[model samples]
Target: MLRAELAGVFRRRRTLGLLAGLAGLPVIAGLALYFSGSSHGHGPVFLDQVTHNGVFLALVGLVVSGQLFLPLAVSVVAGDSIAGEAAVGTLRYILTRPVRRRRLLVSKLVAIVAFAVVAALVVAASGLVTGAVLFPLGRVTTLSGFTIGLPQGVARIAAAAAVVGLSMAGLAAVGLFVSTLTEAPMGAMAATAAVFIVSLVMEGIPQLSILEPYLMTTHWMAFTDLFRVPISWTGIERDLGTQAVWGLLAGLAAWARFGTSDVTS
Candidate 1:
């Protein structure tokens, strides 16, 4: 069932477009850096620096993408999972097959998560590949002014990527929850994007210091801490914990909403 759901998602034209766009970003970044001469004096000018220094750039891209693009991508797949079928009058057909609503929702959630992971990887891989092809490949300098040898640098890069991938899960779950609230795909996507934008704005307010810990965007850049020479795990752990809590709560909300949702049009 999960396999079939995934197949259905990939069959969509929107999914194909997303894949292409995701893959092309890295190539574009690589070319830009290559021509810009940013790697002129850098050591081991592989894509890592692009990946490292590019973290801020990537975060901005992802945040903007998440605001509308990623959520819409997620909604395009999950938003219609149940409601679309209900709208098309196929809910009755699906229910006649002995599939539990819970099982179906779970499958759809799994597929949404899988897609989010692939989307993030596409972004990360694009940056890394672009860096390798255009920049010098070797040791990378840390944001804290310390240098990391190639081996350690690679490991840190991997860690950063993993953190990035996990961060998107929270947003995916939020989109999934919103998906259950509306039959209009646009509504679901817009609601999810609005939540992200609001969170981002809240994260930026200095007076919201007490509320900062609760905002998901606050930890979105937690991976930046990994780029430090000594690699501070403090921010990474806090960010991971915050994301986990948010993801879990959002997932539970989605499950509850979907389980009780009526298919009546």
Candidate 2:
């Protein structure tokens, strides 16, 4: 069933389209920077330096895109999981095949995570390649104003991307739980996205500062701290830990509710 779900996800035109759209982000952003690196009022002023190193492009892509596009792309796939099947009137048929609901739910979660990993890799790979060709490659300067060797920089970029990818797992689990609640994939997608929106809004409100650390999306950009000298693990660890907690808790919630829920199509 996992294999079948994998094939279903990877072979779908809509899934391919989502990935393709994600890949294009690097191209568009890189080109915009390439042609207008010196233009005033164009992206963050700090971003002008990205034109100097390909590694910076990957960081920039992760920083900018991770805020919205990447999460939204993953949300669509995860949010559609069981809900998509139900909307098509195939949920009852699949259940009749003697497959346990838990097994099916596991399959969907696996497929969603696999899809997210691939999407993250694609974004990182495209950003690196595009940045390499358009900019230059060498040691990368960290946000702390310290420079690191090329190899280490590459390693940190990969690690940063990985952590960012893992953060999305929390969002995926939220989407999966939402998927289990409704047959409408669209509603699941919207509800899952609302998690991010609400988090960001809550974070921006000064009154909510005390509660910010608990939101799953709070530590998302913590991956940026990985580029620092000696490899700052505090933020990265906290972010990964927060994401894991959210994913695990949401997965359990979904399982508990879905274990015996009605599945009429």
Candidate 3:
């Protein structure tokens, strides 16, 4: 069941388009910088570093996409998980089969999570390739003002991608819950995206400082800590913990709603 779910999720044209679009960001950025001959410290956070080391493009792509692009992409996939099936009048038919609701729900969640992980890695991988082709690939500088070999730097970038990918778990669960609330995939997608945007907006407000510690977007950028000489785990640990709590709450809510709801479609 899980394998079928994954295959279905990956075989869609929409999924391919999303992945391609993600990979395009890094390639476009690399081309722009390469053609323009930008000097040191002239571009955004990681792009500046990319000028010195191509490996930084991986970090740059993750940062660029993590903000809204990646989350929005996740919203589309996850929001469509259950709702899309229902909209197409397949949810009722599927429920008539021997598959349990719990198992089906689990499968959908796994598919979305898988999509999220692949989406993140796509950004990292494309960035690395583009960066390598456009700029010099060599030693990478750490956030702590130290340098590491190219292989170690690449490993850290891969680690950062994994962390960023897992960071979407909370959003994926929330999207699933929202999906269960409606039959319209667009509605669920919009609502899920709104949740992420609202969280980001609230996190920016001064009065919301107390709530910032729990917002899904709060520790997203903490992946940069991986580039530190000693690698700080405080922010990354808190980020994963927060995601786990959110995922648990949303998953329970989704199960309750899905298990009890009538399947007319």
Assess each prediction's global lDDT (C-alpha) against the native: 0.66, 0.84, 0.91
lDDT of 2 at 246: 87
By TM-score, highest first, what's the ranking?
A: 3, 2, 1
1-265, model 1: which lDDT tens digit per residue? 7898899777878888976776665566556665675655553323334634443334333433434455456556655666666667766677768678777777777777778667766666565555555555556677787777766765665566567656666666677777777677666766776777788898778998899888876776677678787778988788778877877888799889877776665
Best lDDT among the predictions, by candidate number: 3
Query: How much RMSD separates candidate 1 from the native structure?
Result: 4.5
Higher-TM-score candidate among 1 and 3? 3
Mark the regions of model 3 whose C-alpha exceeds 4 Å error after superposition: 39-43
Which pairs of residues collide in candidate 2? none
RMSD of each: 4.5, 1.8, 1.1
Q: What is the clash count of model 3?
A: 0
Q: Considering lDDT, where higher is better, how would the candidates rank from best to worst?
A: 3, 2, 1
Clashes of 1: 11
Q: TM-scores for all candidates? A: 0.79, 0.94, 0.97
Candidate 3 Cα lDDT to native: 0.91
lDDT per residue for candidate 3 within 24-132, as digits (tens), equals: 9999888888887774676557777787788888888999998889999999998999999999988987888767898888899889988988999999999999999
Q: For candidate 2, which ten residues in a row score worst on lDDT?
A: 38-47
